[model samples]
Target: MTDSTSISLPADQRRREFIGGAKATFPLIVGAIPFGIIFGTLAEPSGLSAVGALAMSIIVFAGSSQFIVLGLLAAGAALPVIIATTFVVNLRHILYAANLVPKVRHLPQRWRILMAFGLTDETFAAVSSRYLQQEDIREAHWFYLGSFCAMYGNWVLCTAIGVALGEIFPDMTQWGLDFAMSVTFIGMVMPYLKNKPMWAAVIVAGAMAIATAALPHKLGLIIAALSGVAVGLSLQMLLTQTNTHSPAPDKEPQ
Candidate 1:
């Protein structure tokens, strides 16, 4: 059931491909709502204008970057500093785009760039997981759009509420809601503990995170994520090689 995503599609497939991509992305969009709500509620007191907050959700949709920008603004940082910090926090998108080039290469330049803007950890998870199933081009674009659109809408609406309620809302710290990010990470990681190699990756990454937790400006997160990616990829490659070289298991005698 592999398709052109695995390289080769029928001429008659038409725009059906787009539909698949859109459909696959929808659930992600739905799931993004709570995160967006938290961001809005937390950032409300940071002096984000409705238009400005809306624009942020529209343009710099990355959650981490948005949070950094809000944090900077909360600290009374300069505009240039906030913008630059946001850009730095989102630089990981460059790597995401590099790895994803092959998947969206066939799309128009405008669409490809727009699609790249939609890249996020959750979107990456969905796309990569789909590729594992069959690499069907049908799913990527549609699913991505569906998810992106939902998340985008959620952010905009939440930000609007936060901005509208700016003066009256209680302090965010009062809610102890800042741990949403930590909870989100745990949610993403716990499900991946399926086997030995995955466990190895998690352990290595967790150790690295603790070791580097003292680093400044959220650098520990980057270090830990990269360590996990590298170790996990290496282990997977090694296991693949070993399996390929080993003889097949023998059947029991009747």
Candidate 2:
């Protein structure tokens, strides 16, 4: 399960995988639509032209960083500062990529590149669950593709709708649509709290976020994320050590 090469799949299964991924990603997509819309709604008033907003949605495609970019633009932050801040906010994606590289390392260069472009928090959540369950993981990339495409397409479409409605509802961004994404993430993560390390990570991260909320430019998010990662890693190391040192369970006599 640790390493897999892309294997030829039967056509029907490929279709099934793709469709399955889309379905798995559907709820998150629904949750994200509002966030995407709010991004477009805020972008114009935040000093980005309509074309610029749409381009950022398409090119950047990271919702958190997009919002940060818009805020920094509106505040007249220098270009280097904006870039550095956004980069820091998005450093989590590097963790995501590292987690997935072993699963897809043997795929074609083009396939790897495409998946890299399509990777997102939502897609990673959905596809990582699928990859863990599927023994025939070679075809799981198609599922990833489906989830990524659905999210990407949904974001583009929602951005357009928000842009068109931006004039009609100048205060749409203030309506609190972005909170749905938080609910969606909670839903996604709730199912994965299978061990102590995960619970510790979640608890520590939440506390850190609240404690650091006043920090500027979304630094709280990065700090909380790193704190959570550290807690999880330390707990896992302790667990590993405990398991390695403990005596094996006694075998029952037949």
Candidate 3:
């Protein structure tokens, strides 16, 4: 099957959806600016050339993995080790793609490929609510593209600026601006904790993360993610059963 939002609408609706997506993603973009800049600032010191850094941001487009790679490189880790660590860190994208598959299951191959390339944590966070919460979206993929493109463009520009300023500043990454990423994530998640499954997932994930904080090679992250998924799934199953068994309301007289 192809991968798109499936439903088609008028050009006006598509434009509105696209604009809405861009506007919704703008705040997260603002938060990500510093994180992107810090990555760029640290890249050269981490043994990457300017072109290499820019290319990684453009090609890899994974902020977390890029930073992990840089850190591993700086620490003199073997190439295989660096690659494996980045792979492990990025496994969550699999879950992201699984969740999004239904929305884009009918699109053409090219659009699906573009959407996969553009899938980032920030864009996923912004786009999921729009797709899952709304019952009808005339052209949802356009909205997804809008958010993805805005974040992607912002990240590239920030990286470029950071790289250029890295030589002059030399300590930009050490400036404690990376905390904005945490704040941005918190903002994204807070609005969605509307039910037990969501809350369970977050709580279990947070607890697991804390408990496994000392694990080597960031194995703790994997544990936390898995535990959260299990908990969320279990809770969802229970909720589904409960709903299934509940008594039906009496029908009113016709």
Candidate 4:
């Protein structure tokens, strides 16, 4: 009895952590549903079959990249061009991985690989928030797994629904469901703008995105992201140097 109890304790704790992670991600999941459905609805008109659309959701599982690919296909882009464009668009994941390295560095190779596969914008936002607040690190990956599974399952399911609706309605995409995702992105970003550097990065990125909106193959987004990162880093360094060089105030008499 004692041995069985001991063996079950850690498993129970992990289950709780996983459930907690999924619960925390529920709101974000709500925001992504319409986006996923929209992608499904657009896929067929953009030259993809229903099976292909569902497969992309299950295999590629990247909403933005999938949408870009659909547009490129509709435009009759070359295969290499489509591949290159998606690669450039996904470069932001590198920065996300950099921010998360220290937290997951101690994990084994298999664990790290699984986490990398599951990393998405929503998962990153949800998991990073949990990591920041939670003191215990031992079971955190369970929480990550939970969030990943919830989002992944939701996306695939929503894609299927959209595909069905596409056949039935044939005008579902015209309803403007993509706007929900834009609002969801804003919700994700607003919480992180607690400092000057963050604010500057967002403002610069937004302005640059608009200014360069006509660039081909979505290169404007990459340029805007890079510009924002550069400005933020430069300002952070300058502020650190200024604080280091400034003289201290005189103390009161001891």
lDDT by candidate, in order shown: 0.68, 0.90, 0.90, 0.91
Write down the worst ten-residue block by lDDT for model 3.
2-11
Reference-based lDDT, residue 56, model 1:
81
Using all chains and alpha carbons, the TM-scores for the candidates as numbered come to 0.76, 0.91, 0.90, 0.93
CA error at residue 222 for candidate 1, angstroms: 2.1
- RMSD of each predicted structure: 5.5, 4.7, 5.0, 1.8
Query: What is candidate 2's lDDT per residue for 161-196, written digit by digit as tens?
Result: 889899899988778888899998998889889999
Per-residue lDDT of model 3, residues 158-185, tens digit only: 9999999999999777789999999998
Model 3 RMSD, rounded to 1 decimal: 5.0
lDDT per residue (tens digit) for residues 186-239 in model 1: 665676688777888888879998999887566776787688778988999999
Off by over 4 Å in 1: 1-31, 42-44, 178-181, 190-192, 247-254
Pairs of colliding residues, candidate 2: none
- Number of clashing residue pairs, candidate 4: 0
Q: In candidate 4, what residue range of length 10 has the lowest lDDT sum?
A: 1-10
Error of 4 at 123 (Å): 0.8
Whose lDDT is higher: candidate 1's or candidate 4's?
4
lDDT of 1: 0.68
Error of 1 at 123 (Å): 2.0
Across residues 1-254, which tens digit of lDDT does each residue of candidate 4 receive? 36898999999999998998898788889999999998888889999999999999999999999999999999999999999999988888888899889989888999999889888999999888988897888889999999999999999999999999888988988898878899888988898898899899999999999999999778898899999999998998989999999999999999
Q: Higher-lDDT candidate among 1 and 2? A: 2
* Model 3 CA lDDT for position 200: 99
